[model samples]
Target: MMTYTREKNTQLLISLLKQHGVRYVVASPGNTNTAFIGSIQGDQYFTIFSAVDERSAAYMACGIAAETGETVVISCTGATASRNYLPGMTEAYYRKLPVIAVTSSQPIANIGHLSAQLLDRTVIPKDVAKLSVNLPIVKDNDDVWECEIKINQAILESCRHGGGPVHINLPTTFTKPFDVNKIQHARLINRVTIDDQFPLLEDKKVAIFIGSHKKMSKDVESLIDRFCEENNSVVFCDHTSAYKGKYRVHYSLVSGQEYNSIITERPDILIHFGEVTGDYYNLKIAAKEQVWRVSDDGEIRDSFRKLRYVFEMSLNSFFLNYVGHGTEINISYYETCKAKLDQVRNNIPEIPFSNIWAASQVSSKLPDHSVIHFGILNSLRSWNFFDIPDTVTSDSNVGGFGIDGNMSSLIGASLTNPEKLYFLVNGDLAFFYDLNVLGNRHVGANIRILLVNNGKGTEFRQYNHHANYFGEDTDKYIAAAGHFGNKSKSLVKCFVENLGFEYICASDKQEFLFQIDRFVTKNVQDRPMVFEIFTNSNDESCALEKMLSIDIDKKIVRKNKVKSVVGTSVISSVKKILGS
Candidate 1:
């Protein structure tokens, strides 16, 4: 039981959050959140952490949510503070994490005018939060019960419905101190069972398309695997795929002509879980079918594409109850897909110093229980190609491309999980974009950064326009791509030193491999450690081309206006692909 009176609503709110099992709160202190902060300052139920920038605070909350599998709240003042959370909110929305944003604003009377730190309090970040509620200020003692009810509803909606973010806008007047003994805790509602029945499949050719699933509950994965095995289905898991089992999983192997032929001959049923259907080609194929989707939230749209069935329940729960007793079907399609996948993996050309190899090697060296925060870009792609250890957990919001919020997110994650060793793997461009994040003086020594600097956007170089735009001159091309040219190494060293980090550089394959152990095992000196690895831009371009050329079964090809597929001209194609 929590008491609520004038001047103590904020304390009551914190107590309610603790009761609901919120372990952490990432906040940026202001007069508005002072009472809330003070309430949790020495309390044992939750750890209250601060970030100078609200954007970082939100992302930090995102990381905490990803790790703890619990709702993480972010607190900030109004106006720009709310706006700062937009990028992280977008990321959280797509990734499907429960990040509660508690924003403080001016009183209702002061709103709509030129009040400081006041904005449109009603408009929530669309699609970002499952529920957005504006709590009424406790102007009189009589309003406390209503406020308590709203808070309870907000918490339940945020966690129960799809497990995404929620927003609770608290006006300044509600920050008043109150007695903690008078407030009664709201009774939690019973979990609702989804009554919808899955369509019966009578000896139909069905396939399970597994997308980027992260931190799936064990029960969910086991049920899904049993369902697939019983149905004699093929599962196509993407790079970020999380579920693992000894089922007849296939489909990702079929690429190029084989993939096109299989999709043209559509299966009787297609079931999808998580985000994306592996790649563009798979998505295009799935779009043609009367698909069935099982998700926690109703936000899983068919992209205006109609679905045969939509089960809005936890995938694990749905499968365990409905799919466990289904009869097993035998099909030759599974064998064909597995054969194709084997060929693709076997034929993938070995590249000495490509991003894929780099990712695989680095991941291999990471210590147990290391939390990895990778930037969105080629760095993410590289990690996607490799298998991350079970001990290593990452926030899979790489969907927020070109938004340099991961650095701040990593810093905040390190703060929250202080005992765990953390690593941030980012491209040079991503590092440059969020350089301000390094300004934090409280960064822990356990945080290590591996900056894979290929001079410029090596991922962009895979297109054709880049080569055409830069011509044959290497210097001109590097400069056009925003590389520091010969000064890249110096710049990195200077930047690391300025941030009080121990810096080391590796320019070639031998040096990179040689210094990796030192980079991974070396202790940080009161700040984060940075390992700058240098490689040729052309090498990355060539490696991607080789990967694309492999005769896989499910290769998705986008028809560009300009078609050129020669090894030498691949660089031009890369530039064109990246729109460089």
Candidate 2:
């Protein structure tokens, strides 16, 4: 029987308590305390010990803390029952034992009135407890956020930063039924804005999703890598996410839109941080999941609809505080998602010859430790299907995803490290849009550019583009074809050669393969390299359309065989009956 109630304030307290893994909740039963006691009695996550005497419950919590070297909770009703906790709280304060006394009280306005069972718990003896927090009745979102902060304050004071006893005065009503099955979500506000110190989190199902990000610092990358390893967590990444860490789920999640497999792998606590994602491609997996958004600004950017916690610190600091303390997950969530991806990969047929197919073939050719930047739309979306070496970090301008800055971004990344090779796999339109960067003096011999020229915005030839409905006219005005007067080699070759680059152009797969090996080699021809591979626009769109249905058709074919067998069995049975 699921017996947790719908009281907002109590829900916030319990949600946070579960998050911190507060196991034992000692309850002293009374009329005012029924709201908390009745709700918790049905939940198996908490171990409830009944001690009718309020004073006895407090002393028992102290004894439990002393013996176990763990924080223990004491729950009681309002009135003189709170006074009974003074002696035990003082002992816990002096002994530095971590004991939390949560006393349920009537509303503050009801205290001075002639209302029964009301007491002003606002002012408790300072020395009796390390700290006392009166949690308000959470009616609005603001109240809800405040309620969680106070609960966290009590939680932190009780067990962390030199352990000691703390008091929480919970104000709640007594009418709601104890019928809620799952614990409600609560906002866990961390006050450590600038400090590296983080609070320990106790949730088991932790997920870190990285959207578009800058190249992470080595220290931050190392910390993220270690945190994922220790917690057995997964980092969901795409081509634009730009995070290359261990335990990376480096699959194009946009490809999984049809399967809804992403939704199946939802986490109990999702930690998402990075810039905006290009794959709004139904990331609705996090729709109702607990998310803690980590950012420097610490502002409320609730991308995930079910955001409960906002840690206003660096991703590293937020990760450091939550990694080691409470992750004891037995199942591999990473393996679960990986297995689904592997199954889909096994069904993936020989990709049709197009920009994607060509990119896949040469993706493995990029040198180790090289930085690869992708253009927006077609280029970023296609290369995402292939795997890159972890030593290589890749990114795209998904923040304001536009074709105009792809080459410029590549040049900027190249300037970061002159000795290490920097690379770009871009579409013709994007390259031409940012063509001025090619002549820039900052272009170094270590730079490699793979311009996948589909003649125009071939993406506009596909289903999603508005121009697809405009007929052949899309070839001119929409697809923006016939650029450089459709003479691809003459214009691009002359331009690159004039810009002091080793220009290599391929019109066919065989031609591309013959030169791809040499093109990717260290400092090809000692100048900045441009390998422009030309393809038909239709081929580019068809290849993408083919990939989307690759697994869908395979699954349908398997099920159709079962249907055929069932039909044959029925026909044979009918023929036998007719003969009889």
Clashing pairs in 2: none
Per-residue lDDT over 1-580 for candidate 1, one digit per residue giving the tens place of the 0 to 100 score: 4334444456457657867777788879677766566556656677878899988988898898898888988888866778888889888888888888888777757876788777886877587787777776665654665565557666766676467888888776644454444444432222234764556666677777666666777677677667766776666554455655544342432432332355533566677667743243345446344566767774434421434455677776667764656565554566667665566667767775766667757876777767777766466655654455665666544454454687888888789866677888877776777778787887878878888777666655654336436544543545346555442768878877887888887877788888888767734445578888877667776665665567633334433313334453786778899999
Instruction: Tell me each candidate's RMSD, in Å, in order.
Output: 18.7, 12.8
Give one digit per residue, the lDDT tens place, for model 2 in 191-293. Answer: 3454545444455667787788876887787777767767767777776776766677755633443423455577777778887886554255573447777
Candidate 2 weakest lDDT stretch, 10 residues: 253-262
Candidate 2 deviant stretches above 4 angstroms: 1-204, 253-260, 280-284, 326-331, 553-580
**In candidate 1, residue 57 scores what lDDT?**
89
- Give stretches of model 1 more than 4 Å off: 1-193, 210-214, 239-241, 244-268, 276-288, 303-306, 326-339, 464-480, 483-487, 522-527, 552-580
Best by TM-score: 2
Lowest lDDT sum, 10 consecutive residues, model 1, at 183-192
**RMSD (CA, angstroms), candidate 2:** 12.8
